[model samples]
Target chain A: MTDQPWIAVDAMGGDEGLEVMLAGVARARRRFEGLHFYLVGDEARIRAGLHSHPNLSANSEIVHAPEVVGSSEKPSQAIRRSKVTSMGIAIDLVKQGRAAAMVSSGNTGALMAMAKLSLRMLPGIDRPALAAPLPTLGDNDVVMLDLGANTEVDARNLVQFAVMGAAYARVILDLDRPRVALLNIGSEDQKGTDWIREAAAELRAATHLPLDFTGFVEGDKLARGHVDVIVCDGFAGNIALKTAEGTARFVGDLLKRAFTSSVRSKLGFLISRPATQLLRDHLDPNNHNGAVFLGLKGIVMKSHGGANELGVATAIANAAKMARADLTRRIAEDLGLEHVA
Target chain B: MTDQPWIAVDAMGGDEGLEVMLAGVARARRRFEGLHFYLVGDEARIRAGLHSHPNLSANSEIVHAPEVVGSSEKPSQAIRRSKVTSMGIAIDLVKQGRAAAMVSSGNTGALMAMAKLSLRMLPGIDRPALAAPLPTLGDNDVVMLDLGANTEVDARNLVQFAVMGAAYARVILDLDRPRVALLNIGSEDQKGTDWIREAAAELRAATHLPLDFTGFVEGDKLARGHVDVIVCDGFAGNIALKTAEGTARFVGDLLKRAFTSSVRSKLGFLISRPATQLLRDHLDPNNHNGAVFLGLKGIVMKSHGGANELGVATAIANAAKMARADLTRRIAEDLGLEHVA
Candidate 1:
């Protein structure tokens, strides 16, 4: 890993504003010695947050950007107009080699837009995808890709997603030839639409790849951890992710009610507190903090916009890990982006 | 509510054979007093099984159905060729008023086909939909419709599902003007396709209907009980239902492992037995048994083919309730089927 201390953070982004982002950066810096943050946001607010923490202030630098991109702003328009926006500046730092990687907890669309525009797509990639490691029933998590990044995708795009996702699993999760599967209604070879079927055929025929390309996987297998990488178009992936999140929330809420129902039950819950905490930690979304926008030339991690300090810290760690792993070099080499238009 | 002592069951249907079905029937009969069963299957085998239980033999009748409908067989062809098939014969009994309502834990495709072909669709109904009550966060359950019965749907069909679902809720759950919402990706007024948007408009303008008629609801809201009736096309509804089931199973398996991780945790789990049981009962798919294929002239309930005896009993009770409530009449009146076609 490079001894470069600074990482660029989009401070003006996210629902919680600069305070949460700055707080997360401060926490990450405290945990990692020699880690410095180039906090990109309005100078006044970033300084206000840094004023309280002398240790964090000593290592951090604030880069002033006049305009802030609103969450609702069109990604393309924001990228073109707001060069001085915190998110835009963060991406620019990566492009200029001022920072090893960039972190954003902002409008996902804007982050992808700026990342692509500034750093450019890796050689053979047609489109970049957002990949998140989701907690499964098994000991390890599965890497699922294109979670609301591209709404409409073709067969070729899905295959590309699989390749990138496999690479991500290897570099980030330390998997060897990560088993990849396409998400579908059923596991049958001919279960999905023409695009999915065609993609399955292509994935099967390609023997030159470094990954273990398994055929189709049903939604039920998602949490089973039957495969290391689950590839799909954004629409389906988004639905699956949100459905899982909703189910988790529902189950958690139900458990809470059950535990608090009666005096005896409450006592029982107190005794089983450790077991319950283990389950909660395993399922906690915050623990699985960062989503990497793959197929880009530079590392760009998108934390959940509503994530608290711990979540942001996790995202920072993820960004640092991705940078340390030399993710961009691996992608450019494996995907053979040099031959692309 | 009928004084009829025996209900005819299609024993030859379902993935589990006559033995399991007979076992379920015997269990239900023992628990529900005055409940006798007309076991429709190979009479020789039914008699052989009943040899040990003289009471079951005396109380139950075996209608010999020489043929069985395979799960993979085309529904139309099965209904056409197999007049003596258990599912076909079961529906025939209901049609001839020999039984109050027929129960089938069999090939869903065949049951739906025979029900539509033999019992026929309720007057003015364009297509029949399968509606099931799903347990939600609130005290009551949400009624979701068209769970894989009809793939291609129009705006008018969705409106019809809302009506059917609402009527089912009133008849079964005894809810007044149960809030109905069209399931879509977003709750915005103009989010979905033209068909869904137009349907939303119609639902909003439906003043004469006995429904609260809440606008659009997202997938997450299904568990939150924000709305009582969730109407969607069969494809989307099927996906959502399966996803929920898969997720619930995944989480349940994870919790089991977590609770049994260590001796201390296991002891704590034993102490929390009642609370755990309550949680299990609340989330049990068996308790929420029987998906009724609504909009048909005769009551037809499809229990999960893999369901055990308790599931079959729940399905039988569901059919009995539908028969008692005369769901067909209410559905016909609610949809204004007489005026439609």
Candidate 2:
């Protein structure tokens, strides 16, 4: 406990190879002083990349990993090669107590499969939910979970997700009682699948929990910033998340076209550069990078594969924060209290 | 067919009630020269409302229905009172062969329940799918289906939705062979639930069908203007749709704030008014209002409950277009072909 817990980095993962990952770790080093890392990847390449990133090199140790997990590899296939692969070794660092957390911008399914097999699920969690922060108009980002993790989840799974999500919000957003809502087609009690209604009933009765259950929320109200945690089955959650991302990008594209449509518009765009830049920063996926795989024993953060240095740093910071907050322990305690109630 | 079909309008439905509905019909009358309407609502209100719109009055007749379906009413409750409800009577006009199609902005659950019971499903269709046109970067809007009609659907239901959605797209988008894709979390074949994979396999094998069965599209690609028809189960479809709507509005809200943040931004906004207007029109829900209940015996269009006069008119125009194109017959024929294949 005296020694600082190391955070593992999959230096070989993502679309950009070892250089970007190492550089990202280097960037994160500037933000979080005293943060140490177990840089897991090809030793020679990582060493070579670290030449350009002296800051990361000082705070990190190279752990050689012979193989790399391909982005297109199936979870099963990736799991088979987890022992020697960078993603697998990084996860093993977390399991072996060498690292408190791991960060990877690798094959999502592969990373998830490896992390589950290595770290395993927390005590009370039947299935792990993939939770991520979505930028909202409110003071804090809303955490949405079970995003393509469990395609078909029962009421019990949904209820557990809500508990886990609330715990996560407490750690990440620093809220005492996060307002949680079940995602539905309509806000009415009778709306959505039977499982959803049952989950709603259970959540409504869960007065002993630290979280405040805010009832149902439709897809349209997600970014309105009213609720802190939104829970749903992976199928709907994934669709909603991707749809929101696509729509934001779609409108951004249209905005670009609109600004370039005429000479007068071009002048206006030039004059409004700062204002539009703020909007851009708000909408950028990179600014809101890092999707945490909750319900796991050890912290594992997944960065957007196409993300740049700042995004990777954000993911690392997020993972480090979760680790420091003892998110796993908090969730376990909440689940224990929930079970008692 | 030669006598010219009357499109039934639920004049007392929607948030705006008789005034907006009648005004929308009057506007549609201006666009579609010979379009007749069987306005179903309170007799006195219709007659009084028609006084302002001489265009609609000359082209249409009114049917009296004293009862109005409240937006909060359950579908079962509404169905029990369908005999006296304006929405129910309008649908009955279609079933009784007095009107070619019906348009309502009333309680969607009630409207769907009434329409399904009154019109019945087309042959080879098990459950009805709600299809709506969504704005895209393409020349024509993409038609997505099963938008909260059937919460759960099998592979067979999905296959049928694709066929119905394609048929709707052909009539609405006027494409010879619309590109159809199954909505999934990933573009990969094995990314989703068993039913989704099964549906994909079925759709891939359905080469004899009119639609070009593209493999799979993620929710983010929904507005990319690549596919003409995106098909999925009602739950995911509804979530994706509302998420898109919510994201668009979220961004629009942010844009407004950005423009008004400073005097410089305000000046820029004024100069770029025309360009922003184009974007606003492109993203407006009213420009894409009508949602068709596909696979039904009669065409029933559900407009957005909060839609304005222009939105109502757009829905009416969409319903009239589908009626003229014989959308129901086309879908039935396509289903017959699919069954044979």
Candidate 3:
């Protein structure tokens, strides 16, 4: 870990183009001191966007890229045809050891495909899982993984996810022994399929790992603010994550409608604005934007494509924290592989 | 459709005892007139419970069931030893043609195992899928299925689940052309794995069905009120259902905390009491208690084990509605089998 970590930012990625990305970089620079950035994009446009942020331009050096990856572009097409796209160039810089970490908000599949191929997986990891921090009720957010990385995982893969997840939680949650739980419909041992049960057995036997393997936790327990890491295959993880988001949004919408239906309720909503703002901050997706692709040799943070400037800044800060913590080395040591760095 | 539908009630199935079951029966009888119930439990306890429900007693008869399956008992163990248990006997009544449908709030796994073995599957059905009505934004609820029935299903089973879910939705939601969609992380064609894609292809090919195949729907669209039926394998379905419930409760808890934080907010809560009531009624588990096991020879609704009297009554009313609508016959006809009513 270094005091000054340089992060590669794909200036042309995300729903918004260079301006939003550069503004976020400026904001993040103010948040985290002694940080440098490799701004990968068209040099002219990068300079034009940086006109608003004198501090960001002083800290960032532009790496010229002629092409950009479209949001709808297929992973294979992006990899094969547009090798010089900002997303691809940023990922390449991480592989070349010029950047400690990379952040991109491009097409998810395309970014994942490019990152996995460019940096490659860690020696012992068969596949890298998409790890995201979910907002729980407690002070520290819970880390959930395989959030649409590999839809189908076998027993060995699940055990590996457990190991990787524990290591990631140790860095992000700053806990010596994070309580890990497998997500299931029921908490009983005999519940769920054979694969999950087999993984539990394997995890139980692997006493060398530094995690408390509390048996099975249901989907309802995911937001209860207790468990540190909730493990599941990408299929269930994606469903649970999206469903919780949808339901929250639905409730938020319902509250808005209810409050605006009449004059008394409308004034009540105004009176309770502070309390509602606290609730909004707690449930806001921007506060928990960055989702990292774990198990790769080099760290790659994925910001949500439609995230705002603050969200992009949040993702960049997360990337810097994970990089400074040497998350990759932590995972390598936990898997009993020789530490890459 | 029968005017006088006789349903079997498992008096000792739920977390609450016979008193709660009988009280629910009383409430359900008030909701649906000319409905008869055959209460299956211990004779002494049944009579004691019936003492409070004079109206239900007038329309109900007790069938003595000596044994009771413990909540923690395995399905295989319960089947081998407890044939005369309240849950088992209620299902047996449906099998013997003494009851039109059965309602139980017992061990879900044990109930499923016993019901499948006793009443058997429908003619063209390979296996049974658990179908439940989920609250949506419109006047009607959306029906989602394969909720913990078959954890791992093939393309063929997913197609079957689609057929069953559409039929269930048709009767429950009362829509002529129920919009059915396969549940996936994304609505795109190449979003999920092989099974889901294959199932989508098959559903698209089968234009003979009465449903409007609306491609794929994401988890967020489950409560949007437009899609009539959402189909997925049991594992994903279970997680989605529980996650939605958990998120709704999470929001409700947050609202409570927000409203009670200070004097001004608490007074605002009082002024907006009517609006909060609406939200409460919308998110109440008691208002949405019935989850029916579809593709069986007879209708079987599984209520939550810890459901209160209101939840139990909701389940009974749902069973009566299904029985009158001849839900099994509708499903059989859709699958190209002879309608069994």
Q: Which candidate is the best by DockQ?
A: 2
Which tens-of-lDDT digit does each residue in A1-341 have in candidate 3? Answer: 79789999999999977888888889999999889999999999988888899998678899999999998888899998546899999999999999999999888888889999899998778888998998876778889988888899998888888888989999988999888889987989988989999999877877667888988988887888789998899989989998998889988888888899899888888888888888898888988999999999999999988888888999999999999999999898888832221
Which model is ahead, 2 or 3, in terms of TM-score?
Answer: 2
TM-score for predicted model 2 compared with the true structure: 0.98
Q: Give me the runs in candidate 1 sitting further than 4 Å from their true place.
A: A1-6, A72-81, A95-97, A109-127, A332-341, B1-8, B27-38, B51-60, B72-81, B91-101, B109-128, B150-157, B186-198, B337-341
**Model 3 misses residue A72 by how many Å?**
2.5
Candidate with top lDDT is 2
lDDT of 1 by residue, A1-341 (tens): 48644689999889987888878887888788767788898998888888766778778788998888887777778878658798899889888888988998888877888788889888778899999999887667899998878866899899889888988888987987889998876565645668888989888877677788888877667888778999987756766777777887898888888878887778777877888798888778878888999998889999998988888988998888888888878776667632331
Model no. 1, DockQ? 0.43
Residue pairs with clashing backbones, model 3: none
**Interface RMSD in Å per candidate, to 1 decimal?**
2.0, 0.6, 1.1
Model 1 chain A: ten consecutive residues of lowest lDDT: A332-341
Report the lDDT tens digits of candidate 1 across residue range B1-341.
46443577898888777777777777666766667677887889888988656657767788998888887777777978657788888888877767767788887777888888888888668899989999899888989998878755789898888889999988888988889988776565645567788888887888778888888877666799888888987756766787788888887887788778878777777877888789888888878888989988777888888888777777777776777677778887887832443
Candidate 3 C-alpha lDDT tens digits along B78-194: 888557798898999999988999999898988889999998988878889988888877778888998898889999899889988988888878888889999998777888989
DockQ for every model comes to 0.43, 0.86, 0.72
Q: With candidate 2 superimposed using the best TM-score fit, by how many Å does residue B57's alpha carbon deviate from the native?
A: 1.8
